[model samples]
Target: MTINPSTLVDLSHKLDSNVQIYPGDPLFSCTPHTTVAKDGYSVHTLTLGSHTGTHIDAPSHFFPDGQTIDQIPLSSLITPLVVVDLTSRELQDRQTITWSDIEGASEHMSPDVALVLRTGWSAFWGTPRYFSHPFLSRDAAAKIFDRGVRVLGVDTLSPDETSYDGVGGEQGFGVHEVILGGGGIIAENLNLGGLMNQNMIALVPLNLEGCDGSPVRAFAWKD
Candidate 1:
């Protein structure tokens, strides 16, 4: 007997206090204004960072001359995704994800496909341990850019490690510069582990004009 298509599993992580947010980034908060006991209505004022929770990074995030969230092409935001798991490394190892990693994980990466990296760091959400983890290296960023991939997603904070310091010299600006500079979009803080199938992933970002990035409601579906 086959199960109905509608009966398929739909796993989504709730955007709440339990969700781990990057340090120095805005936290999700809601201010209750009206309640049933007061004005017979319920309302709330929500506040959060543009990069809060699961979100998409516009080119402007890294390049001052790049396109903002509103200017991002819809074609690049939603498409087939290849899930690349890299959970073998320990936490905050500063290990860089190289181009070979991508090639080793998948056969071919199309120009329209979104690359989702699963670092298994999502488990450390809501704790100090979640702040730092293995990130993509500058070489990897160059490789993805060379391959013509416009969108990249990671299950961590930024593509750069937390220990990275942007001080003197060409410090702290490697992978992001290569990716965003190449006009690539980034989706950070995603929970891609819940999805079993790797068919297509839908990335929906809040349409905020002139904004570098915006919070997103990202999910994956398989038929």
Candidate 2:
């Protein structure tokens, strides 16, 4: 079903230097490669990580044999959606989001739906608190997997704790492994406060071939 044109919510975060990002990731930069006055027309050069700002992570982000960002199916990117708001509660550092939390926000998990978690974390996007935003427990991820969810989104840096490492070890991003590795995708660092009981989401990402991830223009809509 198509959403009514009257009700559309922009679920994406504005990308700029001021926007908070994962530590050690390259900072977003935009420069005038040519001036309008001198060069007769304006030209710009931009540089940033593949996973900057409001972005979607392909399985390749965590798995070596996973699909690239460009390989993501449009049907998976744009589909029915539901947001579970957890902003009212206190979600602390390294805190895990239990399955009970999911059951409290919404009664049913539709198969193949893009499930979004709004932990009210984006409010602290420009500060360190953003890093401490809520995360999904491995059990919660498993629950999501069991329910046949197609994609996941969170208003946090990641659904997994970013304080530790897995670069050369096996203790990797469990949430990502559970979802993306299970034939699902993820949208991170979203600004989903404007959405309200939406039914559909359109996540349009840059068609960057062979890339692990790409920034997205995500929006929520309903009939």
Candidate 1 stretches with Cα past 4 Å from truth are 1-13, 88-92, 164-171
Candidate 1 lDDT over 1-223, as tens digits, reads 2334552433234677666665567788877888878989999888888888778888898788899999987777768778877666444545666777667754555587888888887776666666656778778777777877778888777777765244222227587788788888888877755666646777878789999898777777664
TM-score of each: 0.85, 0.91
Instruction: List clash counts for every candidate, in order.
Output: 0, 0
User: In candidate 2, which residue ranges exceed 4 Å CA deviation?
Assistant: 105-107, 164-172
Tell me how far the alpha carbon of residue 197 in candidate 2 is from the true structure, in angstroms, after superposition: 2.5
Highest TM-score: give the candidate number: 2
RMSD list, candidates in order? 3.7, 2.8
Q: Give the backbone clash total of model 1.
A: 0
lDDT of 2 by residue, 118-207 (tens): 888877878766776668887888888787786899988888876634322123478898988876788998887687877888888899
